[model samples]
Target chain A: MKKIESIVLAADLAGTAVFALEGAIVAMRHGLDLLGVMVLSFVVALGGGVIRDLLIGATPPNAVRDWRYPVLAFVTGLLTFVFHDTARALPFMPIMTLDAAGLALFAVAGAQKALDYRIGPFIATLMGTVTGVGGGVVRDILLARVPMVLAADIYASAAFVGAVVLVAGRRFGLSPMLAALLGGGACFALRILAVMHGWQLPKATPW
Target chain B: MKKIESIVLAADLAGTAVFALEGAIVAMRHGLDLLGVMVLSFVVALGGGVIRDLLIGATPPNAVRDWRYPVLAFVTGLLTFVFHDTARALPFMPIMTLDAAGLALFAVAGAQKALDYRIGPFIATLMGTVTGVGGGVVRDILLARVPMVLAADIYASAAFVGAVVLVAGRRFGLSPMLAALLGGGACFALRILAVMHGWQLPKATPW
Candidate 1:
């Protein structure tokens, strides 16, 4: 149990770091002030978990109560603000890869937590997708742009499918670790492949 | 206590109806489909409460658990959809008044709930502002626009000041009803006057 706890913590920290960097990059691109950059970084890194916890009735969400997340996110944000030029020069492929990893981890974790809360399976799956993409949606809204989840890539859909797989695996009596691996792997692969293939949800033409 | 509960319920229902209408009007102007209009109506009507509840750790926020809100919002939306032309022809003054009323009620309710949860006055004030403007933020985001709270009139500031009044009153041992009345009246007056006088928050110019 202790091992599992440690692994979960490690994965969460890793996701937070990756998402914080991504948020910082976006903040820099948007020409936001120092405060704005830091705020956006924190929001993008931990907003999803806070939202998920709120939906599941967890008071004082872990992100708000736990010091580590805010500390790590803010530190990464400060570092990025200081070295924005270098951060700006980051290649697209690596950033996208990290984003996919973060998305997968969040999706699996959200589903796991929801199941523990004994929420119905359907809502739990939706919660997983929300946990995966909710931060980016918020970032886009704050920046005054269409959320990518509703517009550009098949991001939330991928998370949904992954969450479904995790829930299904759990129901089938698979080990939690095994189910998480399968779910995360599926989400990560779909997101990466979608980007590589220029995959997108079809939109109807303007009337 | 029963009287207070009924008043709260009445205010909530009124706010729901008004915001739902507002959301539908925006959706029609944007040429959203029927489904889009209904979804936006539901979201705009209850999203603020949901966010406030989440922030204060009230899970399955009242808006989600109560069937009345969704039903009211959707029915209002449907009516708007069926009479979009008439809805669009609505005079701006009346709509703005309704909006202000809803905002005032929501702001007071948000602060009250936060206080009930034992949140600090400072945060409770912010929560009030959030509850007043969060739905509109979500609505504007769905339409891919900058949130009015950050860009337009002194909307959120008005809510914050009103919340401060409410929290201060409570701290001074004032009755809840009196505090709510003072807070709501202040918020309503500010929002209306801001609209009437074209009051706006100052923005820093680009370098």
Candidate 2:
């Protein structure tokens, strides 16, 4: 149980860091100064989870409770600023890979939490997707740009797959850890492969 | 009671429009094109409340619940783009005044909701201020600029005052609407005056 909890925590931190890095990069792209970068990092790391917690009546929320989220965000922001040129020079593929891992974990955790609250699977799956993409959506909107996930990408779709897997695993009586691992792994692998192959969901059209 | 509810709803819509306008202006200042302007407007109008709701356990949130918010935002955004030059030429003072009203209303409403959920006074007040400034903070950050309220401005302070007044009024057995009105008025008046006189709280020493 302790080991499993630690894995969850580690995944949460990893998610926070990747989201923070994404915010910092967007800030840089927009020519914001260091303060702007740090603030965006904080938003990207904690914004969605904060929202999720609030909706679920989680008081003070994780961001305010676990000082680690803010600290990690701040550190990520500072590091990005310090190594602006070098960080930016790294190819986008590696960054996307890291992001995929974070996305998978968040999807699994979000759905799991919703299930713990006894919410129906449909809402749970939706919440999972929201939790996974909330920070990035907020980050992109703040930067006044189109959110990357909403564009032609498998980002949201990959998260949905993970959420469905988790729900299905539970019905099949899989252990929690095993289910989470399978769900998370599927999400991560799907996202990475989708990015590599330029896969995208077709945009829905009313016309 | 029904009449009063209508009034509150109207106030919300008006606030949405005013905030949307403020967003468009900021986008113009940043030299954003049409799509950027629309996106900024959406963020500035709904970002704060969305964050506040998420924190307080409001599901699907106002952004999703009240389709009017986004629709109003889009309309004002298009209007701003179509009449960019005229909108730019308008005096800043009136807009600032309207924004002050919106801030006051949102702050009081946010705090009241938090208090209704049985959150403590300090946290309630924090939520009030968050609801008031969240959108603009997101807006400015996206524009690669410092948040207006945090910048030697009396913005959040005014919201804090409003929140406290509401709490105090409730403690004294005042009606909810009455307390909210008093608090909201205090916030609006103070913010307007602060903007006029360039008032601001002392910034804490930069660690």
Candidate 3:
């Protein structure tokens, strides 16, 4: 693969693996079959991107057009099924790290996509944030739970910060790769730290 | 309410009622609480139409702009909660009949909305079908079940038939309201008969 292609592939792999694990957790909770687990994983990985693309009038959204994404998700899901016991035994710490990485990549990719479409910066930032949390929201809704991002965390806020940074970096003549790395690193580091330390936004007080 | 408003309200009420009952069925199976039941009902009633409208570039999808749709769903959910045992004991036959009516009205409304947007007839027909089945698909996905429309049923197909007929009628100088009713009626009757007699499209031969 070319350089950008390779980067995109890496991003997809990270996203697929993390989302598959999350889906597996839900499946285990629901006592669903292996097939159901795989289905939910695939849906959680692709659902947000598809909805985003469709809303922006991108026909045959990236999830449908890109064979690699689905293939990666499916393979990841299969592996999760095979290693269900081992996976379950592992602590949540490492998986949470992977999830943060995936979120960083997705936020960057989503902002990049909006920029390519010539959408306004504000809209691009919103899209990036949505892309970052879309899958988790879909997963939660499907599981009949509130979305994790909305729960006292700075997940989407971090995405917004990174996207704005990326935009500003580009405006200041930084190369795309350098800017993306800066933004992505910021998001990943911040999210990881937040998760590790149980950091969260203050809850709203009732009047 | 004005005459048209009254008609729209009646249709909305019927559709929401049918959709809420469908949601309640799933909620009962999952043993979710009253709040869960209402949330699922709202999703099932509006999810598909909202998706279709957004894809077609309609601003403020009907479900969002009109408060009545959700209000109807909420009321139906509340009623279902109050009469849980009675609602559960009702035979599937009446519920299926009401579902058929809701399907017909939604199909007509979707086609009309597409035409209002100046989309072509074929695409409008597709939109109609999507609007008719979209909510149910979202609900099923959230419930971790495969959408019922993907099964060997004529549900969406019937919507397509109705849309095409309505378009043809309009082309032949029929009144919009009259054409809509005929087309919608055809869809309602077809669905009712299909469910009653186990009608289905021919399966694709395993090549």
Candidate 4:
């Protein structure tokens, strides 16, 4: 149990760091001030988990109640702000790879948490997808852009698939750790392929 | 107790209806499809309460668990969609008045709910302001517009003041009903004055 908890914590923190970097980069591109960059990074790193926890009746969400998460987010934000130009110059492929990793980790984490809270399978799946995409949706909204989840990409779809896999695997008696690995791996692979192929959801037929 | 509950329910439903109308109008202006219109109306009507409920450890969110809220939102959306031209042509003052009423009711209701949940006065006040503005923030985000709360107006300020008044009044031994009435009335009056006078918060100094 201790080992599993440790692994989950490590994965969740790593995901937070990567998403914070992604949010900071977008904030910089939009020419937001230092404070704005920090806000965006914090929101992108923790917003999804907060939403998921709140829905599951976790009052004073871990993002708010636990000191470690915000510390990690703010530190990541500061580093990104200080190294904005260097981060911006990094190759797009590496950034996408990191983003995919974050997405997978969040999706699995969200689904597992929902299950732990005894939420129904359907709601758990939806919660997982929200955990994967909620932060990015918030980041985009702050920047006055339509949420990418609703507008384009195969992003939320990947998260949904991963969540379903995790929940189904658990029902079939797989260990939590094994289910997480399988779900995260599937999400990561799917996101990478979608990016490479320029895949997107079909839009509403032009109003 | 039942009387208070009934009053809260009526006010909440009224607020939902008005915000749904506001959201539908914005969707029509943006030329979104029917699906988009319904989505926006639903979000705008229920987003605030969802946020409030989640923060206070209310699971599943009343917005999702309760049938009446969504029904009211969808009905309002459909009406707006069908009478798009007529709604669009209506004078701005009446719409603004209706919006102010919703904002006031949400502010008081949120603060009251937070108090019921035994939250701190300061946090309750903040929650009230969130409940007042949260739906509109979601609506603006869906339209790719900067949230009006952050960008301009005395909108959140009015809600904050009203919430503070309610919390303080209760602390001083006022009944919940009386506090709500005073708080909501203050918010409504302040919002109307701000609208009429074009009052706004000063923009942050550049960078």
lDDT of 2 by residue, B1-207 (tens): 999999999998898889999899889888899999999999999999987877766767789898889999989988988998899898988888998999998899888987887666666776788888889887877876546554447777788899889988988999999999999999999999888887655321221
| Superior candidate under lDDT, 2 versus 4 | 4
Cα lDDT tens digits for candidate 3, A1-207: 398888777777778678777776665556554544655677678777777787566754675455566667767766776777676777887877888888888777777787788878778877777777887787666666677888778788888777777777767888778878887888888888887787898887886
Give candidate 4's error at residue A192 in angstroms: 1.8
TM-score of chain B of each: 0.96, 0.94, 0.91, 0.95
User: For residues B36-77, could you state the per-residue lDDT of candidate 4 as single tens digits?
Assistant: 576578788888888888777667787745557877898898
Per-prediction count of colliding residue pairs?
0, 5, 1, 0
Q: What C-alpha root-mean-square deviation, in Å, does candidate 2 show against the real structure?
A: 8.2
Off by over 4 Å in 3: A34-36, B1-134, B137-207
Rank order by DockQ, top first?
4, 1, 2, 3
Please identify model 1 stretches exceeding 4 Å from their true place. B1-42, B45-49, B52-58, B62-137, B144-207
Q: Measured against the native two-chain assembly using Cα atoms, what DockQ does each of the candidate structures obtain, in the order listed?
A: 0.17, 0.10, 0.06, 0.18
List ranges where model 2 is wrong by over 4 Å. A33-35, A54-61, A203-207, B1-132, B135-207
Instruction: Give per-residue CA lDDT, model 2, range A97-167, as digits (tens).
Output: 88888888888888888788787877788777777888878777666667888877899899989988987
Cα lDDT computed for each candidate against the true fold:
0.85, 0.82, 0.75, 0.85
- Superposition error at B26 for model 4 (Å): 5.9
- Expressed as tens digits, the lDDT of each residue in A2-97 for candidate 1 is 998998899899999899988888898898998888888898998888888888776578888999999999999999999988998889998889
RMSD per prediction, one decimal? Answer: 6.7, 8.2, 9.3, 6.4
lDDT of 3 by residue, B1-207 (tens): 399778876886778778877887677668889898888888878877887777567857887898888888878777887888888788877878888888898888888777777766666766787788888878777677655564457787777778877777777888778888988999988888877788875421221
Best by TM-score: 4
